[model samples]
Target: MTIPKRMWWQNSSVYQIYPASFKDSNGDGVGDIPGIISELDYIQSIGVDVIWICPMYDSPQVDMGYDVRDYEDVYRPYGTVQDMEVLIEQTHARGMKIILDLVVNHTSDQHKWFLESRSSKNNPKRDWYIWRPARYVDGQRKPPNNWIGNFGGSCWEWDEHTQEYYLHLFCPEQPDLNWENSATRQAIYDSAMEFWLQRGVDGFRVDTVNMYSKGDMVDAPITDPKSEWQFAGFQYCNGPRMHEFLSEMNQVLQKYDAMTVGECPHTPDMAKVLKYVSRKEKQLNMVFQFDVVDIGQGPYKFQTTPFNWGLPQFKHAIETTQNLIRGNDGWTTVFLENHDQSRSVSRFTSDAPQHRVAGGKLLSLMMSALSGTMFIYQGQELGMVNFPMEWSMDEYKDVDSSNYYKMVADRSHNDPKEMHVAKTSLQHLARDHARVPMSWSDAPNAGFSAAKPWMRALDDAAICNAKQQQSDKSSVLSFWKRMLQLRKQYSDLFVFGEFDLLDKSNLEVFTFTKTWQNKKALVVLNFTAEEQKLVYPTEVRSQKSELLVSTLDTPASDKLAAYEGRIFMLES
Candidate 1:
């Protein structure tokens, strides 16, 4: 298999491995890099071309590894930097690329940079992070701004040592880095990008990439007044100087042909998405746009303001992304699940338990069939559902979720009787749900580790375990394997195809067409439980185009069962 020079990521299928829960080699009850090495065969067997490992940086675990205490060394629990080197060697040996999580937007408050910055107001490196006196307005005492932290409190933390408030968009312990300072940005670039590229990482999934280079203006009036915090997330995401900082990063990473994909929110901005991926680019190859993921509800955290945006809305979002990126012949990275998201199978399959598989495949077709780099977060291939009521509060580990439970229900009129229901919904949306270990074996702990797993293992592991699915003729895993192989089989369909939207009227189903040169693929997916009929548009006349993949029996035999999805080659 000769690898195409131009198709480095276009030919790749990235599998994200959250190190803390992937697998545990030692009996210490936490997953480590050695555990990841032990599972290479399983990952390679699934046809993964890229392994995007989450941050394993030495940290206080305040916000997991998002808060880095040491940018150059691995946490002792996960393993040493030498262990990461071994993982990289093994991955490349298996013909796979590795993307290290880039969490440069912020650092642990305990980091030496912050330690010096807080040592004194006039410390030599005092300007390395956002610092301000306790804010005052009209002679009234106040915090620096009205911005609320993503994890639930004031975004500013008062540093008693320095008598100043420091900015922290996330948790207080994870202070936002002052990217405005040239030296600070350059130094961070040298440590995170320069060191890793030299050590042999293929790329990075920049954490909160848009959140770096935040707005320079301070204490602006709340743009989104309805937001509980009153300020929009834009205050810290993709603000002024963002491109400048990215360009600086691009200069360094490009020296090693290292790729980057930013987890950008609302980022496929018409022509904006192409800017980074331009053949004459500044930084990054692609970004994970969030509009599609946040489609259904106004705020996924709040159930009261449910907007009821369904497949129609989600389909439209995907189509818009395809059209926007295709216009520039640019790149895009598509994802259905990640460390922070509700599973697609559950999101799209509302009523039918049986149709969930079809629903999952349907989402896959609509997204993957479009021209872009594709990423399948762990367990997404298995159509994994969210943890149900069995989940106790202690099993969860997400600041966003813990906050959602406290501030919303504990203080407001969101219905306390449905505390468990609310908790379950929030739990489903929590990163920990997807963070559950992949069901490799049906052993007592799903064989993720000999020790007790981080999050509770899914209870029905016997039926959904990977060992059973691998041996069984019919399984979500089988469907995914076939789909991946087919993507490799029809390279153009998976890469350079042009996407055309069809029948926006069908709210219950998602439909689209992919055509490259003369080849065509029609993808239709049913998202609901009802036995609905889809009247095909005249342009898409491919009833017998040979179903390449399906989640249910052919509709010709009966009404398309709930959750039925199919990808087909259009008949000329």
Candidate 2:
């Protein structure tokens, strides 16, 4: 449960930008690498330390860049390798780090490796992909197992040339790699990924890192006969060879002085997270924890509207995650929104649009002040809310939502639409909700581009534009700037500070204390629509804690207002 070394990354604040939606330079409707480069000044101004980019690799775009045809090459839509190099240089020049998304769990069926593997049974690269003979029982065509794809069908994709089933946890075009092959592992470590590290890229944000090493023992008995992907995820995810492979990767990273962060599913067990990010082995620097992001959802197909999620659960998950981190090993990557989620304002607050500002500010202060690295997705700084567009069925790109509509919505003879509704609600909870394009200007296309956007930006781009927020002192952007600067300025209070949760009586507000030496800081946040108060702790109320940062114009004790948050500090 101890972090042996005090590395710089242990306390850095990271900002994530989904490249395709960040900014489009060429006015080609889709965003390019140059678009991101253009926004460098804006990002640097916000006081973020690291910029994590989702996959920009060349792909068929079938699953919206998840299916990478080339692991190393930048897609022409994103720009050339030279463009990325320029972005990396700009980031370093501005004193920020660059993080690349590594999708090593699977390769696009179009990848040269998969092409060769699928070419013939006798091909030298035949063993690189998982291929097995189809199962036959009672003269029926079936997958080798009852495993299902996240997209709703079988995990097995048929290969016409080889007369075999190739495994894919996602789209059929994305075939899972067989990590048992040592040669394949070496190739992944050596290929397109090494290109950036040699050029001084800071680190990697490993995508679906656990999927690479699956349990090799085949025909395992099902644990839950109801859910397919869950069974497969349990079987293959966090498998036998994961630690060995991650340790080897860590060895390479150790030589370069870079970092690696695995995208582990949002779970509460520190022991599970410690397996990959702990110091004894140091396989990864941290993991993206998805504790608070699980709230909010809706029904799908016949019904597709979000429902109210109680706020207490969100506070509980956050406290639970913080306690786990405080009680265990390694650091945590904390975030409220990202490329894959619906906007935070829409998720956390009630239906009142007016409360968005107070809500955003409250969320920012509470999350950033917590110990460990903080991740602020783009537009989060500007308080971007969810896209209010009435999305037609044709405009949707999310795989999970689309599949549920088709399977449980239409052909499946499932009883009622309860399961489909539940599936839709969960998809809404997934991070994809917030992945829409950033709104940089209120100009045509909201300054993201001069052309149409690939995905719609949030509905209120007029008010949420960076150009607008940058000028207003009371804007969400300003609040974020203040929060970020405070953290950087008061490292002792934020970076290495120990967290102690306040009494649980205030469910409408969350409070905590951070003490080091004689200095103390009390953090309080109001989560409900009504005003809330925190009775200061007996030990420090009179001596140490003082008002440090507050989202309220006046303390709730002074006036009754909804969505106010406060952070108080004690004199040394």
Candidate 3:
């Protein structure tokens, strides 16, 4: 495999902004584009090269902007098209790029296209969406197949007007589009890409990209016949024409020198995934796989009875992804926290007050040193943790979490013990944990808004807010700034080096080496809250080594502090 010449995107770090929870400027309790503009300096201060704002398109926000109604316009609460134009201009002036979330797997039921498609079976736009007739079973009408949605309930929703059921892999309001139709695909390009690309935006974070090409309509396999969520993932994921669609999308990106990173869920085949991102294929710059995120998942991703923690298991998953694309032309997008996952500090490390900062630094360093682009979620630099378990169900606002809670309640009715466990699972793994308004200051609403916030900040925002961390030299935010500087200084070494996981038998510690040309860099990380000594290989001992960076202010010889990480540069 040959190393390709570095591009601007390859060398830059990404900061993901969940628009609604980032900052609110109108005192209307919702974040807007101007709110983001207010924080431009704060984002630039952290040294990130790109800002990926989540969908702010026109919609009812049934899925918090993922359900797009107008792909070419901004949501009213988030500002207008003029505001977005200024945002793009201001972002470029600051020497940083901005990308918008492209959620095209489905369209809101309110969309003009959907409205036309569902108007009548004989409508010219009838084939724009996946609509099927209901089947009769035992003298009762039922859905066409046993497919289930990601947000709960059957994937098929009956439309009284058309007398047919429409497929929705997510919320029923978000109907799946028929990518099999060439006209529909062209509309996606025209609205989602060409319009935004012409406005001077950077690229896109393709939502559910692999689901664009679904297979023949059929009843999916079932593991638990009684459960409401059927195993229909294969029916709409990584389908036969997935690569073809992505390759076509790449043509649009290449014309504008833009980049794209696709969200590829439930796709375990590395060879198949590589096909979508290989340089030769020209499909995408990289892909985000959930191997590491699925560490604690049960048979199904959202099942309550997930496996308990074992550091070695996590290490194996990360190393597997690293090795998969190390020497190949395929690239991986490395991240631990995002809009839909739990915070990394609480999920992957000991979140005790004493170790939180160290653990945050360790994880940031590990991801930064890997051979791919790094994505930093908003507030992650401040070492944010999950919301307090004390929050009740009413306090949570995510649609997916609410739907799952009702499903669990119906299945395990009147069983208080089972209900409690399921609630705890939601508390730890729900998408809303990362969706709370960012903690910008210690003031009310954590300074995210002057008015009441749509979602309350975590209880510990007083201590974890960015204002507090920015003032303290030893805070996680400060360490993140330093880490970004180091990455910029060693761009080629970190982005082009070959990775090798070392001491795999050592469960408590994670270690790896990145070698490029005649130089080698070793990264050491301790997963526990207890100090440990490094056991260097014989080759490392003989090299001329220089201390590069460490989580601790000062290290005791050969010893690592609780949850500490360190990097060493060796000259051969």
Top candidate on lDDT is: 3
> Of 1 and 2, which scores higher on TM-score?
1
Q: How would you encode candidate 2's per-residue C-alpha lDDT over 1-572 as one tens digit per residue?
A: 44356887777888887878888888888888898998889899999888988888899887778788987788898998889889999999999999888888888999999999999999989999899888888997667877766676778888878899999988998998888999998888887467778877888889887777767635545654655533455667787778899988888788888877777762446688777777776688887766676554322122344645555667667766566556456677668787767777777764256788888888888877877778888888877776543455445567765676566555556655665454545444544456667888778777787887887655567877899889888888999999999998887767767777775655566677776556678877777787655666565566655677788656655432577778776775
* Per-model CA lDDT versus the true structure: 0.76, 0.75, 0.87
- Please list the residue runs of candidate 2 whose C-alpha ends up more than 4 Å from where it truly belongs after superposition: 1-4, 217-230, 266-268, 296-309, 327-329, 411-432, 537-544, 556-560
Off by over 4 Å in 1: 1-5, 138-140, 220-228, 266-268, 303-307, 350-353, 413-415, 418-421, 542-544, 553-559
Better of 2 and 3 by lDDT: 3
Q: Residue 474: error of model 1 in Å?
A: 0.8
Minimum summed lDDT over a 10-residue window in model 3 is located at: 298-307
lDDT of 3 by residue, 29-117 (tens): 89999999989999999999999999999998999999999999999999999999999999999999999899999999999999999
**Which lDDT tens digits does candidate 1 get at residues 1-572?**
33224658766889998888788899777889999999888888877689999999899887778899998999899999999999999999998999999998889988999999999988878998988888677997677778877776678888888788988888989888888898998889888778888888998999888887677646646655555454547666768778888998888887888878888874646566677566566677888887677766444354543235655777777877677556464677777788887677766564135565566666665555767788888877777777765667777778777777776666566676667656756654566677777777889888887878777788767767778877765677777777778877887876667888888778776778888777888877777776667556667764557677666545554345566666778867
Candidate of highest TM-score: 3
TM-score of every model versus the real structure: 0.93, 0.92, 0.97
Q: Enumerate clash totals for all models, in the order shown.
A: 3, 11, 0
Query: What CA RMSD would candidate 1 show?
Result: 3.0
By TM-score, the candidates rank as: 3, 1, 2
Error of 3 at 308 (Å): 1.1
